[model samples]
Target: MIISASTVKDTSENVEKFVRRNLLGGIDHLVIFLDAPLPDVEELLDGHPDVTCVRAHGAWWGSTPPGGLNERQITNAALISRLVVGFVWAEWMFMLDGDEVARIDRPVLDALAPQQRAVRLLPLEAASRLHPVADPTLFKRLLSADELQLLHALGVIAEPKQRSYFRGHMSGKPGLRPSADLALGVHHVVDTGTGDRVDTVKDPGLRVLHYESHDGEEFVRKWTALLSSGLDVAQHKKRAPVAASVAALLSLGLPEEQTASLLEELYERTALDDVESLTRLGLLVEVHPDEGPRRPRPPDDEVAQLRELLRRAADVNKRMFKPRARNQRAPALIAKLQRGLR
Candidate 1:
């Protein structure tokens, strides 16, 4: 199996330890791509057998002299290369973050005995706003290089949660888009629970617990540091308000009413869920509008609806104007419509 990650030094140790304990009986090999905390990784894999570690940088391009490539584009390039390599030769491979761990009750090989396809479905377990996840899993299908490139073109990997591309094939309201294609789930713990280590995976039979949020600090430091060096750190740092709202909701446990108010205010200028997500990272901040009263927020139920409407509007606007999608203002418009409906 191939697992790809960049800037995952902190959490990868735990993941590696967990994998060593759990996964067994493999005839071929296991390859892991890790980008930072070189010494720590070496320590974790010191005596492990049948494991190959690549001192990989997330960037598709090679390292940047002593520092290594820092930009997201560069990291994406590296991931694509790994995907290409795995798709060609490997029977089954995984694309995941360092903070992520693939969990199963039995051996991974046993799970694959029934499936005959080139790509087997794996589960993705992400934390839920209401409950602490116990066994998080997802049914993920393996992809070839061409399919990976298609997903990249569709903005799946770059911004995985945005459901704009496949919305037509989706159902359910504004919450987690449910799919019957495959049952694989990802237990995303990064922004869900209090401090990220609260088991949020729902299925106990097959589970993977991601400890990256707390463990991957080393990677966080390195990548952002690189970002600060290469680009305008101050500008990247402007995402504070969005980050703060999520903290207020999940960490502080603000009441639904208060949370709704904060989300409403944020939705006027941005997506409420986006603000909540950013807030979970503790990276949100308020920014003044250039003109007008700015965006307005609707009732709680309408928050996600507004986001979807905004996304659709943005798609429509893009086709009509053919203008670049620079911090697109469609979210603001949806916020306005939602407020009007309310």
Candidate 2:
């Protein structure tokens, strides 16, 4: 089994932690393909002595090949990895993004067969929801390399229409391999950057943590800069808005689901009149901008206003001590004001 990772510095911590935790007794070789600069690559290798590290120009192992204005750095990396798999005599070659981790319940080598094309390991997804809890689910896996060349050939080209078919080709079969009995799951920790504190996966002893969600502004900056140099510029930029929203929501003490709802309320302008009232009463618990003023108090103006309102109600009640004729307006006004106070 070969563990391969291609990444920049932002994800280095997650990759390092994942490798340290999961690369246990049976793994024959641990290979990390660093797509960052040589200096960053050396930095990643500084502490991780158990894993073998290789520096590369780009990520090509599990992604589409570059074309047109896009450079072929990724394509070259893919080709190199394919060759390594074939030549290294690896029975099982597992490829993943640097932020992604593979969690196995049973030993991986025990599942391999002599003539199998490739095994599809699924991921368990961890995400935050509005209910103040985490949601965990199973994710799909990529092909185990039976024929590296075939997989590599398809990877260099964009095949949105052919993705499923490509998986079939990797399976070396007509369509998807029907393996209902042995469903190896992948836990995609895609929304690690989410605000809601939800546990995404069940208590399945098997799950991999994909650290894509944990990335912050620095990660975004580095990735966009690197990918923009010679890769798909738009693809790298697409994550910005979502990432920003996630960061903003986290700043708001609300859970993921509540944040989304609050955002929706903000968009609809439904929070306008009630905003002041809620804030005054301490009913609104919005995250302060810049973490400023953690200990919040009701505004003096609001407190004064409430006091004046109560005083006016008490004065009116005292003035209307006796019930007047049914036709009198003073009693009606007093009743209306009292109702309003309630």
Candidate 3:
């Protein structure tokens, strides 16, 4: 059977969406470790047959305080991955994030060769806020050499340094064979007994759709905490450039509103701004996101209602095209960031 694990500190709505979507994607059970003191998800999935919510106050997180969020995730994933063998009959267990949803129609491990101990699912990052194809969300992925050339030729990314195609991670997450003495690390699976990384088979068909901060409000909300929290995320390869910029911005200690204002243009430029061009170029793929909840919910948690508001009102979508020159408003932001760097 297919199972998944995650450490989430998200609102009930997003949690509900993630659970239902993954369940529909063929995950038999989801082991969710609550990393927050209070988020409505535990009550939301109180007795879900297919979900187990391990609270922060429970014996789980109580053993020791995690050094940081990523540490917590790594710990939780390893804990459940090792522990799941006792209670559940599972073949593959995926460790992803609350902001991520696996695009697995049927996660079958039985067909995998005996040596294929783990599977890697590359992420397709959410780029647009609204698309005619909102059945799922519009996400950007790493292009092939030819596609990368097309992007450069069309000036989609403009400078090589400007965009990394996918903004979050390229290493991907793993789906491990639980019986293989496996533990989920930050990005891949490891043999707990030997402390060696497992050989991973990268599945192009199976992927993780990441809904990172798609707007300025979300962009600030997500990054401000990390940049200022001393998480040392700037050392992360994919995140270093932007993380450094945001950390620099935070050092300025400018008013919250000013920081957000400065980041507006930067967010637009780095985010997948032109969906139409990407789609035409076959750089975007569409998946249908499940709107129904795994369990019955209050009025606010309904999918039919949430989907429209989420698409048309709450979130915004943008077109894809050539990367443009930096906006006039961004220079002061840059100057201030430079000052912070000093």
- lDDT value for candidate 3? 0.62
lDDT of each: 0.32, 0.34, 0.62
User: What lDDT score goes with residue 320 in model 3?
Assistant: 8
Stretches of candidate 3 exceeding 4 Å from the true structure = 57-63, 86-88, 129-136, 159-163, 228-230, 250-257, 291-342
For model 1, residues 103-207, the per-residue Cα lDDT tens digits are 433243335433322222233222222122432221122234655455556544443332321211111100011111111112121111122221222222433
lDDT top scorer: 3
Model 1 local distance difference test score: 0.32
For candidate 3, write residues 151-210 as lDDT tens digits: 778877764432456667777778877652567766877765556778888766778888
TM, every model? 0.33, 0.39, 0.75
Residue 315 error, candidate 1, Å? 42
Worst 10 residues of 1 by lDDT: 172-181
Q: Residue 293 lDDT in model 2?
A: 17
How would you encode candidate 2's per-residue C-alpha lDDT over 188-298 as one tens digit per residue?
111112211222222233344433322122233434444444544445344444434444655778886776565544322311112233234332222111112112222
Q: Give the winner by lDDT: 2 or 3.
A: 3
